[model samples]
Target: MTVLTIIADIRIKPDEVEPVLASYRNLIPQVLPEPGCLQYDLHQDNEDPAHLLFFENWESRELWLDHMKTDHLAAHQAATDDKIESLTIYEMTKL
Candidate 1:
């Protein structure tokens, strides 16, 4: 199995940050048990509270892609729609 690591650095609108984070926090429990999902975590920048980081681990790239298409993920995306200023996604594998 391939170990996939995804890091997403997201910037949320000033006033929307807290709500966005709360939304993500609330959604994590629902997301972590999905097929192929190994881990899911959210982090906030020490200096910049508006900046958020998401760490996701999956069994494989295809499984991660499948997770992206789930209804829960879609709902999460819709909830944060347009509230994000920027988003960067990175994928990594074991050496």
Candidate 2:
């Protein structure tokens, strides 16, 4: 089975960083227990508090896609709406 790796790079508006972080705090726990979820860790950029990343591992792309459609994920997105400056998601496989 091919493990799927997801790197989500997010830039939050300077003043909205705290709110966005709070949303992630709620989202991560919901994600970790889901089927095929191997890891769903969040990271902050030391130099730039407004920049954040999610380094995730899943059993397969299909499971990850299902995760994307989950209610918790939608709530997070709604909560952070307009607070995100930019977002980038990279889906990959190990060599």
Candidate 3:
């Protein structure tokens, strides 16, 4: 099975960057323990502190899909709802 990679671009209200970061930080531990998750890391742009990016690698598309239903993911989304200005997720595979 082919591995899946995802890049998530997240923009938040400038004032809420810290809160959103906390939410993501809490989520990482949960995601890391899940099956098929190879890596899940978060990054912030030096120029734009409110802009966050997630670099993720998974064992398969199916496993990644399963992750979408996880409670931690849902909670993170809910907690950051008001703080989030925009979100874009790109799913990719090595060519």
Candidate 4:
């Protein structure tokens, strides 16, 4: 098994930050039940309100890929397409 963490430095338009965050909040319930998904969370930066971060855990890389291909993920991508500034992904394994 593997653990994957995706840190997305999403940049929302000054006025659209709240709505963009709300959209991400609404996706939690929909994304948590995906096969192999163990945990999902969202975080905001204290210094930079426009930056958003995502923490996700999955059983394996393959499972994570599957989750990425789901309709829910597609919607997520569409919603944040141009809104995101940069995204960084890290894959880890238990010692």
Best-fitting candidate, scored by TM-score: 2
What residue pairs are clashing in model 3?
none
How well does candidate 2 match the true structure in TM-score terms? 0.97
Tens digit of lDDT per residue, candidate 3, span 50-94? Answer: 999999999998999999999889998889999999999999998
**Of the pair 2 and 4, which is ahead by lDDT?**
2
Put the candidates in lDDT order, highest first: 2, 3, 1, 4
Off by over 4 Å in 2: none
Q: Estimate each model's TM-score.
A: 0.93, 0.97, 0.96, 0.81
Better of 3 and 4 by lDDT: 3
Q: In candidate 1, which residue pairs get closer than 3 Å at backbone N, Cα or C atoms, i.e. clash?
A: none
Q: lDDT by residue for model 4 over 1-95, one digit each (tens)?
A: 44765545466666667777877888899989888888888888898888777777787788889988888778977986676656666565555
Sort the predicted structures by TM-score, highest score first: 2, 3, 1, 4
| Per-residue C-alpha lDDT of model 1 across residues 11-94, encoded as one tens digit per residue | 999889878988898889988888899989898989999998998999999999998998888998999988989999999876
Give each model's clash number: 0, 0, 0, 0
For 1-95, candidate 2 gives per-residue lDDT tens digits of: 89999999999999999999998998888999999999999999999999999899999999999999999999999989899999999998889
> Which RMSD values do the candidates have, in order?
1.0, 0.6, 0.8, 2.0
C-alpha local distance difference test of each model: 0.89, 0.94, 0.94, 0.76
Between candidates 2 and 4, the one scoring higher on TM-score is: 2
Report the backbone clash tally of model 1: 0
Supply candidate 1's per-residue lDDT for 5. Answer: 95
